[model samples]
Target: MKMKCLYVAVAAAVLSLAACRSSKDAVSVNDLDGEWNVVEIQGQAVQAESQPFIGFDAQDGRVYGYTGCNRLMGALTLSKPNKIELGQMASTLMACPDMETERLMLNALASVKSLKCSGKTLVLYGADKEPVMLLQKRFEVVPLSSLKGDWRVVSLYGAALPEGMETVPALNFDVTANRVTGNSGCNRLSGAINHDGADENSISFGNVASTRMACPDMDTENQVLSALNSVRSYGLLDNGRLALMSEGGTIVLELERSK
Candidate 1:
């Protein structure tokens, strides 16, 4: 009986401590309320064009923001009033004109190990000795038509175009007719293309038809096949080449209209 009582008391104490810790970690939505302007971005002085910084807010302890380019959403657990664990973030697919600035912002936010506010300045220090970024409260305006179009590949891996293969082949696609007709780099192929057609994009190829050619470069052919299968985003460039990027914006293949 005594042992059982002792176990119950210990369990209760543990539960109370856990509850307290959870409450301590719970960040209120009001804490993140209001706009946050990028006072200093990537260690550069803010220019007139970069005046409007991003805005962030906490909704039920979840963090959401606009990084002057795309929508940013992530979770954060407040360990204390001045310290927190920045969770993984997912953003929209709008390609920023200044990709370097956006990348810097993302890297900075993702690397945030701890954060604190001094007067009106919010200081964010990244993980692993990364540089610090300072932000201030401000309002912002977002554009609607940021992402759109039929994109091509800026480049491709494996044999840029395969020489030969039977089942899988080197390939290229065309976006005008929503069609993909190419040498599977070894075999001849044809297919229908489908796309979301939004500035924030999502696209795919339909069933593909091909003339099975048996040559060589099986590895290149595999790469082509993989690229075709995994195409989720695309960027229409100034050049005729349609740069097809992956979900992570990594260029997987470039498809130019075959003349």
Candidate 2:
């Protein structure tokens, strides 16, 4: 009887040590300290939109990443043994023209409950649909500063306007002023904005009230209204192209600053 008890105690100690190691290997912010890309989003198709995921220190034991359209930051807590929870992530106020795609990415990340490593792929899933963030391991990121300036629009979405409606006209957005005051296709218009000084990426046009001008091209007029009302996020991309991308790479319009 005494010999059996000794063996049982030794076995328990070994099991406990193994459990500790497993828990340590679980997913945490420390493990996700580098860049990542969206290899597979929402368990549907795989679209690697953002090249490199940028993770920066939030000074609060959390990590932040730059999605193609918006800034994402969240908390990570690793409970014992296969139990993990990715806290609610907060994003900047940029209305994506492609609302569908942006919503999917945000929803996936928000749904991360527990994560596991499958070879080189890091899969994140939830016990339920609470939050879902599935990301693949990625490499370094190249910081670009050329993406800064006033951009204009080239295209838009939504319904066509009446004969005299201006959805959105030729716009010249000044990031320095944190304002987007420009010609609304026909009339002069202006509104507030928020700029990312480091990258010139900005957002604006919430509740923009413009002068009711009667233009010959009602399409332009209706477009002007849609642009202001639907303006969500804006970014300065390569080649001096300022893209006002909506919910899903939907380029509401692309404009160039005056050289």
Candidate 3:
């Protein structure tokens, strides 16, 4: 009987150590510095046209956000890694067609006991240590400096690229030289980027010439070149995506961040 009791104690100790290890993996609360678009609740995507969002003020230790129907604000506190405590959250008493999402978000804030943060994503966990909410960084305005990196084409002209292609279109920005170099589906490309000079986000690609290698997807490469010429601005979207925009605010190409 004593041996069985010792085994039970050992098992409990192992479980406790596991929980502690999981908590240590959480990122510092200070990581949540910018406004983030609420993407999911309890693993379900939010389909409402009105996008819900949340922001944190590290210096002030305060929280503020919009619920797609009303505004919310509250005191925020963090005592240790993975743990977050939001004081009695107060929201504007506004009514809308549906308030289910709003209720779920507010409840999450109240019940969440832990959290995890990645480069631009944040997840909130409840007492059960299960993720209750997911959010991604949202950029209202993008700067030229913010886009200095490599990117790969995810979608072309609002449609997914065809599969089984020899090469996928991609671009690497050299901000110092004001040049972009990469593969344009069927050929190697080199180009110059011109800042609109009017604003930080307004940009245009110029003299984007490419190699003359004719491939099976030459048609796709031609379309890609046209899209680059028409790009007038850019925006950072959720999930680390960049959207090249046209004159009419249409997304001409969607690129994902690459190494």
- The lDDT for every candidate, in the order shown, is 0.55, 0.53, 0.79
Descending-lDDT candidate ranking: 3, 1, 2
Query: Which candidate leads the pack in TM-score?
Result: 3
Q: Best-fitting candidate, measured by lDDT?
A: 3
How many backbone overlaps does candidate 3 show? 0
- Candidate 3 residues 1-259, lDDT tens each? 9998986675445434312133335454336655678999999998765678887765578888878787899988875555788888988899998799899889888888878876567888889989989988665456788778889999887788899887889999988899989998979999998997666678898899998987887778998999999998887875568989776445688999876
TM-score of each: 0.41, 0.40, 0.48
**Candidate 1 regions with alpha-carbon error over 4 angstroms:** 1-107, 110-154, 158-176, 198-200, 237-241, 256-259
Residue 94 of candidate 1: its Cα lDDT?
A: 90
Off by over 4 Å in 3: 1-26, 140-235, 238-259
